[model samples]
Target: MSYSKQKNKIRLNLVIALIVISLFSISAGAKTLTDLADRKLSLPDKIERIVAIGPGALRMVVYLEAENMVVGVEEFEKRNQQRPYIIAHPELTKLPVIGPQFGGDAELIAAQNPDLIISSYLSQAEMNNLQAKTSIPVISINDGSPGSMTEAELKMALKFLAEILNKNDRAEELINIFDQHKNELKSRTSNLDLGMNVYIGGIGNKGAQGITSTEANYPPFEYLGLNNIIEDDKKSNFTISKERLLLENPELIFIDQGGIELVEQDLKREEFKYLKAYQENEIYQLLPYNHYTTNFATMLANSYFIAETLYPEAFKMLEAKEKANQIYKQFVGQPVYSEMAEIFGGFKKMKLN
Candidate 1:
């Protein structure tokens, strides 16, 4: 070969070596994360922007004070929703709707150019599909089930997710607030047996699910000394027969605002009218906690309200409204208690008569 041709061939080999090194370095420096689902994934070291899907997924982002990181939301979060997190972060309602859960559009998610995707809860199959379709790393943080977590599963989820987001300080502050209030509520009502079998009727699971909708082993009641009659009969969420309800005849029944209308409708029924709580008009209003997943702050506030209702003497110093405001302020950065209360009654006894 000519001398000049040999020199050019050597230069080409050096260029190839540099390209290979650069690719290897890029691959080597990638960060690895094990999400709550226990799925191992290699992600960019820096997660700048994200897309959140599934129930309460976007709300959890707000808790991290990381709304700035969210580039898109699901269709339902676009509205001026009642979830405290949604109410606090007005910017979320204006973001692009990446479509619904179960069938998120990868093209739409790609359009947002998110570096990560956060889901509140997703079946393993759903998680695999989302990650595969978008070619984006997806993490599921659960704080929804009682079996999954103590008090609020979302609370554990927040701390877990915050570690991943490098927001541990903020997560600690949030957890402290939850723990402090929960402990306070527990301390006062721990010993007092209100001697009352209570039923939280008119519970709304997804939306206004009517009067029959209720939670078994409700976290709020568990914190207080109250015994939920449903505790012995069921595990999670299930509607009880009105005939069975009449047989149990709980002394107190608190209605969730989400199911207020349905509760009112149920009150019109003669069968429901015969119940002890309905007869005495013990139905009171509580903010909806299950909407958009667990409203941990609201759950605490409602506990105080219930404690006060059952033992007015013990909680005379406490004001459920004030407590709700403090919790909302801490978690949401805005005390949206009044706004929510005005829309839906707060700790007020219903005058069904």
Candidate 2:
């Protein structure tokens, strides 16, 4: 062969090899959706900074064990803010104003210079607009239904997070742990005769309506083997009137933070002071764990607390504080059990008349 022709052939092979390498890089780093309606979600080369815009996303971050990666959150995203898992972390509370949970300050989110944005459900227009304007990718996961969140959805979300954080083994371990606790709780309380007259009061300040006394929001109460007394009583979601609460006269009432405030306000009124929940003290306040009701971790915590409160003898096999510590350390990855206990302490031993 001519020397010039041979040299040209060698150069052509080098160009082809370079092209193949480029294609491989693109494929290996491609973004993907983990579930339904999920967009082209993929992890950055390394997710050193992230902005979690919803409570569900916060739960995902906690499960991924990426608490330190979170750079921002929605206005109402509660958790380690006051005394968080990481000391000196920026509190979303004092951060610049976002319009609301769904509508945060886009400019501020950009300013945070996050590698990825994790969100739950956002309106289509909002999501699309943000994607177009921002260089960072926004990945969303479903929050499941209000009737009850499914284990399937939780698993799916966790898997996506695991892929992003490169913690597949830890994610699987968390799921296994979650399933173990769930099965144990279900089995232990399966035959407890958890009769009717269980009520969950008031929505949160951010407008989370509590569980329907009926089948509408059945997951949490149903999980615990309790019947929500107000499920069918009201057609719409709102705070139950004193008359309704008095009439239902639930055996147990779970008062949310907002509901607790409302009831406290009403107690000043002579008329509402004598209601069954009030007089009997059957109400249990649900402290805000991550700004919303009932995630997997919160549900487990709530279940243990409620089980001890309802069937003390059965749960007497284990100490409640120990149970709390186990959940905090194993699941939440934060073993500040004493601090969490203090925050949740008020709800533990309150008498419900």
lDDT of 2 by residue, 1-353 (tens): 34795687467545533432332223476644443343444456667888776446666777677777777766654434433232123444554443356546678788778888777666545566776677777766563333233565676667656666677798779877886776677677887886546766654434444422223344456666776676653332344556676666666666544344454555567654565656666767654432443345555666677777777887889665667568767766765556644654434534432
Which runs in model 1 stand beyond 4 Å of their true positions? 1-27, 101-103, 143-152
For each candidate in turn, the TM-score is 0.86, 0.73
Each model's lDDT comes to 0.75, 0.58
lDDT of 2 at 33: 43
Worst 10 residues of 1 by lDDT: 17-26
Per TM-score, the best of the predicted structures is 1
Candidate 1 per-residue lDDT, tens place, 65-170, comes to 8888988887777654778887778788888878875335677887898898887667767777878888888877762233213343565567667766778799
